[model samples]
Structure formats: C-alpha cells, structure tokens
Target chain A: MSRLGRVLLGSLIPIVVLVIYAFATRSGLDPYYPSMASISSRFSELWLFERVGSDVWPSMRNLAFGYLVAIAVGVPVGLLLGMVVWLHDLLAPLIDFARSVPAIIFIPPLILVLGIGDVSKVLIIALGAGFPLLITTIDGVRKTDRALLDVARAIRLSRRRTIWNIVLPGAAPSIMGGAQTGLQVGFFLLIASEMVGASSGIGYLMMRAQASFDSPTLWAGIVLLSLMGFVLNLLFLAVRNRIIHWHLAMRAVSGSR
Target chain B: MSRAMRKSILGVAGVVLSLVLWQYLTVGGPLAQTPGLPTASGTFERAVKQAGDPELWSALATTLVVTLAALLIASLLGIGVGLLMGYSKIFSTALDPLVQFLRPVPPVALLPVALLVMGPTSNLAILMAVVTAMWPALVQTLVGVRGVDNVTLDAARAMVLPPLLIQTRIVLLSALPHIATGIRIAASYALLMAIATGILTGAPGLGRSILFAQQAGDSALVFALAVYAGILGLAISQAFSRIEGRLTRDYGPTAEAAAS
Candidate 1:
C-alpha cells in the first residue's frame, strides 16, 4: 500500500472513535461526555480571548524565562565541572542527589519561600530543566576527543583558544540533545508548578475548570496544553537540526555505513 | 595520598562544607530572616524521624506499588506493540503519525481528564503513569527489533525453523538489550507520574505528604520527604542499570550504548 494510504488507514481508528464519542454525547447516551460542538466552542473561546491573555500567554512567558535561565546557568557550569576533574569529583554525589529528586517535589517549598508568583514557577522549571542539561553538557565536554586536543596543542593553541574552537564544537551535539530533553522537563514542571499554586496559566485554568465541573473547558485546556507541547517540541527540533546540521550529517553517514 | 583517596576525601569535604554553609545561611546568616525555612540540622533530624512515621511509610509504599504495577503494564504493552510494528513495515507506517503526535504530550496534562473519567483514585494514577511510561519502551523495542540482522532471519527460514522458535531465539534475544533501555527510561517516568498523580489528587503517597507538609509550613518535613523521594528514584535507577549491564554483557552493547 502507498504511504498515504497507510497513514489514512491508521488515522481512521481515532477518527471513528471521535465520531462515536460525538454521536454518543449528542444523543445523550452519556451526559458526562462533552459534545464535539461544545468542545470546539470552548476551544475557540479560550483561543480567542479569555485564556489567551490570562492563561496561555503567562504559561508561555514562564516557560521561556525558565528555559533561558536553565541554559544560561547550566551550560557554563557544566563545562567548568566537566573540564575540572577535581571539581567534578567533589560535586558528583551532590549533583546525583539533586538530579534524582523530582522537580515537582520542590514546588511546595518554593511556593512557601517565593509565594504564589511567577518567580517560584520559573525557578521550579529552571531547576527541573537545568539538571538534565548540566549532566549532559558535562558528559559531552568530558568526552572531548583526546586526538583533537593533541592536534590543538600541536598548533600551539592557548588553553582558552583550544576550548573555544575545538572543545565546544565537539560537545555541541550532546549539549543540544540535553537542551531538547531540558525543554521537555521544563514544560512538564511548568504545568505542574502552575497546578500546585497559581491564579493563572493553562494548568491553573484546568484546575479551576475541574473544580467548577466545566467538562468542556477542562477538555479545551487539555487540548491547548497538548498542542503547546507538540508545537514547542517541533520548534526545538527545527532549531536543533539547523544548529547542528554538520553533526547530524556526520551521524547519518556513520549510521548508514 | 593516592588519587582515589584524595578524590574521596575531597568529596566528603564538599558534602561537609555544603552542610555547614546550609546551616549558617538558614540559622544565622542573611537567609535566617526567611520565614518557614528550616536549619540544615533540623531538616536532617526531621527526615530521620519521618522515616518512622506510619503515614509516611504507607504513602511511600503506595507510591512504590503503583509505580511497579504501572511499569509492568507499560512494559508488556510496549513490547507487544513494538514487536508488531518492527515486524511489519505497513503497520509501522500506519502508526508512526499517531505515535509522533501523542509522544510529546506530557502525561501530567492528562491528569484532569483522568480524574474526570476515572475519578480521583489510585487506579487513575496508575492509568496516567502507564500512558506516560509506555512510549520509551515501545520506541526502544521497535528500534532494537528493526535492527535485527536480516541475514540471520533468512538463514533461519532456510533451515525451516518454526516461526515461534526463530522469533524467540533470534529476534527477541537480540531485542533484549534495547527493551532493557526502554524499561529503564519508563521506570523513571513511572515514578515521576506516580508522585505527580498522588500529589495532584491527594491519592495517598509521599507526594501528598510533601504537599501537606508544605501547606502546614513544616519546611523540615517537606525537605525530608523530598529526600526520601530522591533516594527512591536513585535506588530504582541503580537497580535497572545493574540489570541492564548484565543483560547487555553478551549483546555487543548496541542498544545500551545508544541509550546512554
């Protein structure tokens, strides 16, 4: 079968399921299920006005700020830790313990300390995102090819110049991979922290809808959150592919061979 | 001192130094002004005390049970689906889009829906966890199965080996290393989801206790519970690593290497 035909065939099941759900609710077979029309209306309502300003925008802002903070701190610290053997050894246990703890656990204490504000949420997201990137970056930097370093030394390159040119470039692929993972972690924590204590944001919106028993609104929040995650991941992938095109090309060649 | 001994001493010193700094900041330094923050010694003492609390123990037990159950379910379903997709090009092509679409959606986003459909129960928590944890195992298994050498399969076919025997002896064995990778990843997700579900729904777990402690302004207790959760995560991950190491010892490290 053609690729398009296979995709259509695969999609048919989910479509049929949705159709059955819509019909079931429309015919009042299940009062709990929100009808398709109501869900769509709620979606537009959120997208057009009420939620866009109050919930979606705030959530996106927090996510962006948190991610930026994570990258800014994680990359440099990771490089230093990875490059300095004594520092790595001294901090290994502490880092392991910190990373093992789930980021959600920190939300409560942070809320207590920072109050129910954007700062707390952003910090939680940053902490959640930072560890993965830090670990990956350290691994990448530590694994820098000895042969490349030797070549740099053969050319009489200074330590700073060697790292700037050879080490950073060599570690770029792993660092980027870490960044991708960190984004996912950041998004998860963003919703989680928002849910725990917040007046606005998609997670808060969902919680409020649930409390009010507004099924359609709740469903709308879920749909919007899913779309946000999906779109952000695609955007990250596009950026990563562009930034590390050479590394990817090299990987492809080696993989095929 | 030898290099290893020096490193060990420095590591211990790092821990001690951090503890002293933590104590000073919360007990006497500028951070002492921060309300509700506990001293380092107080937090550690509370953590030890909390270990004996029946409620805390029960919550921890509930989380462990839910996580293990979810992991088991996810691994079974993931391996089955992965094998099906790997063995059939048409099936894989059909499912690729759906998998891609759903994979990136954080499982926490499904909590409200799960609560609505299933109510706030342990079952709901398990369902959320299973959904979240299944993907890694499924994807890894698919990759492992697809990478199985075609020449070996062709040789088995020429020898007229039974299909079941061929699958068990060749494909499945080759796929074990990759499946192990998936299981390891899924195990972490399961623990995270279990805690998240517990906290969100007040479904009886360490997460709920942590929330309770925070709400009560018992910062020491909160810190203790957080430490327990971290210990649990580390233990599970270490256990999986050991198992994976043994499994991949003879597999030439294809799947495990890619994973790490």
Candidate 2:
C-alpha cells in the first residue's frame, strides 16, 4: 500500500470504534459506559494541567527513579556475571528461583513492612523491573561472539578497549531489547504498586474513581494511561533506532524476524 | 571435577548458601528483630503445613483454574485474530494502529473497569488475563504469519495443495517455534495476571491468602504463601519454556527467520 493508504487504513478502526462508542454511550442506557464527550472532558479536567503536577508527576518520577536504578544496577552486574562463568553458575539457581516469582508479589509485604511511602513504592518498582534487564543483559553478554573475541585477543587488544569496542557493541542489541522490556515492566509495576497501596498518583486516582462509581473520570484515567503508554513506546523506539541503527539495517536487509 | 559436575555442585551450593543466609537473617542475624518477618525454616515449615490444609489446596486450584482457562481462551482467540490479521494485509493495516496504541498499557490498568463492570469474580480475573496475556501470542503469530516463505507457499500451491492445507502444514509448521515463544510468554503473563487479580480484588487464590495472612498477622504464612506462589510460577514457566526450547530446537533455529 502507499504511505497515504496505510495511514488512512490504519486510522479506520479507531475512527469507527470512536464513532460507534460515541453514539452508543450518548444513549445513556448503561451508567458504567460513560460517553466519550464526558470522558474526554474529564480527561482534560483531570490530567490536562491540574493533576499533571500532583498525580502524573509522582507516578512518572517513581517510574523514572525505579527504572534508572534497575538499569544502573542490573547492567553492570549482568555484564560481570555474564563474563564470569563461575560466578554466573554459582548464582544461576538462586537467580532463577527469585526471578520466577513475579515482582508484584512483593507489594503487600513491602507496603506492610515499610509503610505506604514513596520509598516502598520505589523499591517495589525497582525490584520488579530489574529482573528483565538483568536476565537479558546476562544472556546478551554471554552470547557475544567468540570469533570476535578471538580476533581481538590475537590483535592483543587491551581488555578495556576490547570491551568498549567489541563486547559492548555486540551486546548492544540484546541490552537494547532488554531495556525496552524493562521499561514496560517498570510501568506495569509502577501502576500496580500505586493501586495496591498509594494515596496519590494516576493509579490511585483511577482506583478512587472506581470506588465511587465515577465512570467518566475512570474512563478518562484509562485514556491518559494509554496515551502515556503510547508516548513512552515512541520514546523507546527513538532511543533504540538511534543506538542500534546498524542492527536494524541488518534486519531490514535480511527481512523481518 | 568435570565442567558439568562442577556447575551442578555450584548450583547446589548457591541454593544452600542463600537459604542459610535467609535463615540467619530471619532467625538470629541482623534482621532477626524485624517484626512479622518469618525465619526461613518457619516459612518452609508453614508451606508444608499449608499443603496439608484442603482450603489452601482449593485456593491453589482456583488460581490454576483461572490461569489455565485464561491461557486457553487467550491462545485460541489470539491465534485466530492474528491469523486473520496476518492473512489479510488490509485487515492488519487497519488494526495494527489500534493494537499498537494499547500495547504498552499494562493489564493492571483494567482493574477498575473490570471491577465495576464484571464484579470481583474469578471471571474478572480471567477477563484481565485474557486481555493481557493474549498479546504476546497474537503479536508473534502475526509476525510469524508474515514471515512465511513466499516461495514455499507458491511451491505448495503448484503441488495443488488447498489453501487451508498450505496454511496448516506449511505456514503453521514454519511458525510453530514463534508460536511456542508466544505461548510460553503468555503462560507467564496469564499466571501473573491471575494472581494479581486475586491480590488486588480479594479474589480467592494464593494472592488472597497472602492478603488474609497479613491481615491476621500470620507473617510466616504470608511469607510461606509467597514462596509457594513463586514455586508455582517457576514450575509453570519452566514447563512452558522447556516446551518452547524443544520446539525451537526441533524446528531448527537456522530455519526461516529467527524470532527475536
């Protein structure tokens, strides 16, 4: 299809769904199904500028802190473990057992132990989000090509230089993939922790709306979240393309996986 | 020692060492004074005791049932939709935007909608799981369908194979490894969402048990249930991953385009 054709075709579903929803909800038959007009108005009222500081900022900040911490700790440790076979082997069992437990399980105990503070929320997000990056980084580093290492060694490349040039670049695609998942998981945990035990943030806002049967505001929260998700993904793709344009070009040449 | 032997020894030592550390911290170490946290031995013993209780077993059954039911529905619906979307470029182009728009929205976001609309039932959990867990399978199958070799399809057509037969024998087979990856990930998502629903909505499951244990101030039981839930997740994910590994191996990684 032509570029214009693709855009028009892609836009078709959302437009149709919106039109149908708009007409159906305006009938006012079901209270649970809020009208699009009201929902959008509520969306603007709740998130446009008012709650952006109080609710949205807190969630985003928590997600940022947690995600940054996870990456900072996870990447170096993962790289080291991946490089050191003995250390990885020694920790494999423990790591596997721990990772198997979904990170959400910690919300209750963490909240109970540490109280419903930002510290608990941040820790919950960090612990939950860290696993994907950690696991993928370790695996990615381990998958670094032996032939590349051999050539580097034959050339007597310094250890530091070899890692900077050969190892890191080769592992970049995997780490990049891990980073995307890490952020997605981080967002999931962020909302979940807030929902579980939070007094502020978008999750709290939506939960309160539900408790009070405020469908329009609740629906608005969903819209805000979906928008957040869309933007976050776009940003991730931008970073990914910038970093791994080479890998992507290779894929484009070879065709889709 | 042989490499494999040494590795196994290290693995065992790692597990034992962690458990010892856990025991030390909760039993008499620095963290021993931490209130409501159970000793490693206490948690393990509680797990054993919980196993004997029929109520706990019922809770396990509830969670597994929800997870399995969701997995089945999600797999079937996802593959069906993915097939349609993949088979028709027009359909895929029309729907891709809507799908992509929602991709990053986590399943937890649906908690409010489901609670009001569906009530805090196991069905609500199933609904969440289906919505969330089905994505990986659907997305992968869409990719898989697109990745089917054109020449192979043409060759099959030349042999006078029906379109249905071609899709089944050639396209589906070629895409089986990718589907396996999807299903494995889907299993993890399904279980996670199910337990999460329980935890958040007070639905009946190990998650609710944890909530109740905490409320009752049974820290040891809470810790034990969390441990048990971890084991359950580990077992389910390991089983699926092993299957995925076998399928990918049997299909040969070098075959077609490899799944990312």
What digit string (tens of lDDT, one per residue) describes model 1 on residues A47-120? 77765887888888999999999999999999999999999889988887787788888888888899989999
Worst 10 residues of 2 chain B by lDDT: B251-260
lDDT of all the models against the reference? 0.86, 0.86
Candidate 1 TM-score to native: 0.93
Each candidate's fnat, in order? 0.59, 0.65
Error of 1 at A62 (Å): 0.7
User: Which residue ranges in model 2 land beyond 4 Å of their true spot?
Assistant: B149-165, B255-260
Q: TM-scores for all candidates?
A: 0.93, 0.95
Runs in model 1 deviating more than 4 A are: A28-31, B1-4, B149-166, B254-260
Give the top-scoring candidate (DockQ): 2
Put down candidate 2 lDDT per residue, B34-136, tens digits, no spaces.
8776788988999999889998889988999999999999999888888889888888899888888888887687789889898878999899999988999
